[model samples]
Target: MKEELGRTIQQLRKVQCYTQEQMADAVGVSVAAVSKWENGVSCPDVTMLPVLARYLDTDVNTLLSFHKKLSEAEAASLISELSDIFFDSGFEAAYAFLLEKIREYPGSDMLVLNGAMALSGAMALSSTLVMDGDQKAAERYEEEIERLYKKASESDDPAICSQARFMLASRYMGREDYDGAEALIDMLPDEQAYDKRQMQANLCLARNQLAAAGEIEERKLMLAANSLNMVFVTLIEIAVREGRLEDAQYLAEAADSTARALDMWEYTAQLPWFELYTHRKDRDNCLKTLGSMLASVTDGWNYTSSPLYRHMRKKEGEERFGPRMRESLLSAVEHDERYAFLRDSEEWNRIISAGGGTDRGAGQDET
Candidate 1:
């Protein structure tokens, strides 16, 4: 811990191009004391933190890092609190709050880690609202996503580093930077946990540990379900790319049916149907499908009659896509270049007309 403090002091001082003697003079300490602190041979008194922090232009918390280690439970609680702040206030406000937290505990890799997660989640929620020729918001979000992941990549925590590298690779894939993505992926630790888990499961079975075996079997079942979802997802993506719209829609429905059976959270699974309808210029069917799909998910009277919804949670901002997020997602679909033809259609206009002052509730889907 003392060694870490020493390194922090040295790094901050060097970033400002300050020598040991200069730092000591600024903080009214001898060069020998500064050298000892930086060398890990000695630590500074608590009383000297303010002076040391001022000289380094940092907070005492940053200088001390974590004087006492945070428990996993405590860290999880903090993560949840940060998430709530994000949903309650707004992205900008949550970002400001996270920045302050990072400054306060500069060495807390979890802070950088959670910030990356929050920003990444916010990007998805915000992108739904982006439309053609209005990409300013999307650009800002992607830039911040890159910045946060890059910061997390430098974290000391292995878990934090691993997740950051993977997310960075994903971002590179989105940008078609295949080489960059491959480089990032190459830095990740190889998957050993799978082998270990299988070994443990085998051991449990051999020992007649029925309870343990059941838990392992449950985990294996979950993994199998996820694998099935991935396979179908890839096929659906291929269908969409190939312009096999009907096939894509069918596969999507199949996937969603399986998803609902597994009690998983569902998102906008019908957006592709809109694209297909628009492509065929079948305005009426397109609008009907859109209206029905929207009706199924939104927190409106339509949900009351839908068999897909048994009892809906009315939590304000905790849905798979919350009210604002759903609205934004719909806007993104509306402005997609492929569906621009629908923008002028009377069927589309009908929904637009309904979305006036008389029907402005975030999730009020009315035909």
Candidate 2:
């Protein structure tokens, strides 16, 4: 044990480019004592552990080689911290910080996967996207994201690989590379059992609980539903690119249905997502989609809170949208000129009036 601890100390010191004299000086020990510790002729007394860990940029337990795997909460905190860095420092700084942390914790698949998610979200959500025909900047983020996903896919841990494969599958779908997406999804099992021998070791290491068959399917369902939501958006975009307005509408409807089934109201914002209705002079479906949005959000339907899919939240158990959600969606669509055709329709007036529109709020249904 002493020799193992000495070896770890020596390795960390050299990796940090610290000489025996420099390390000894930093830790209030003699150069001879540092040499003795590295040679396994002696151990650092308990008093020196904190100083050594600080100098080496690690904790005392790790310095003493008494390492423990990061618990679930610790892993979550790390991911959250990385997210905050991106928000505060911009993507370039965050990316550099992430790579540094990955090197600092090389074996943690959780860290790698979470970092990949952060990068991908930053890319998709950034509003200042350069729309050069090729979207070269977007491609860079996507490429890096794919590289990180590949790294996680290669992990021996099923928990990590399952999520990586799902994200990669969604990316493939977004690229319209259907075969690639399907192939990745195929890698996931239809069911996994807590008592299953093959997963016992992996489960024991990461979660320490067996995933029951029901739990396994629930995970797959959530993954598939979420991935499919994005996948349909990709398909809709492709249809729009090809100028197939009807096809885009059909795809949007399919995506909306799937989202409703999963209770992922986030997709509701995109109900009439494509601008094709106004472009093609198709008013009925446009108004219909808008009406559906109104109905979906009316009477406090709780679109984002399906018990089965609550885990899909950006913050678990928190409402993804606020009470102002209905107002925001209605206002955006109502003000868009593309839907001006519906301005005088009785159904449209009633839709507006029901939502406290000054035109006739008194006689309208509160719902």
What is candidate 2's lDDT per residue for 1-367, written digit by digit as tens?
7786787687566545578999888878889998888889998888888888788877776666665555667767776676667667766677777766654554567877888987776664443444335467667767777888887887778989999999999889977999999999999767755544335445544664433433544456766777887787777777887988679777767776677677665434445343445445555555555555555454344523666744333453223233234555565556555566767677677777777232211211122
Position 222, candidate 1: lDDT: 52
Candidate 1 structure lDDT: 0.65
RMSD of candidates 1 onward, in order:
7.5, 10.9
How would you encode candidate 1's per-residue C-alpha lDDT over 81-156 as one tens digit per residue? 6667766776666666766555555556666677778767765555443634557766876776577677778767
Best by TM-score: 1
Candidate 2: residue 151 lDDT (0-100): 77
For every model in order, what is the number of clashing pairs? 1, 0
Q: Name model 1 segments beyond 4 Å from true.
A: 6-57, 66-76, 124-142, 193-227, 240-250, 253-257, 260-328, 334-367
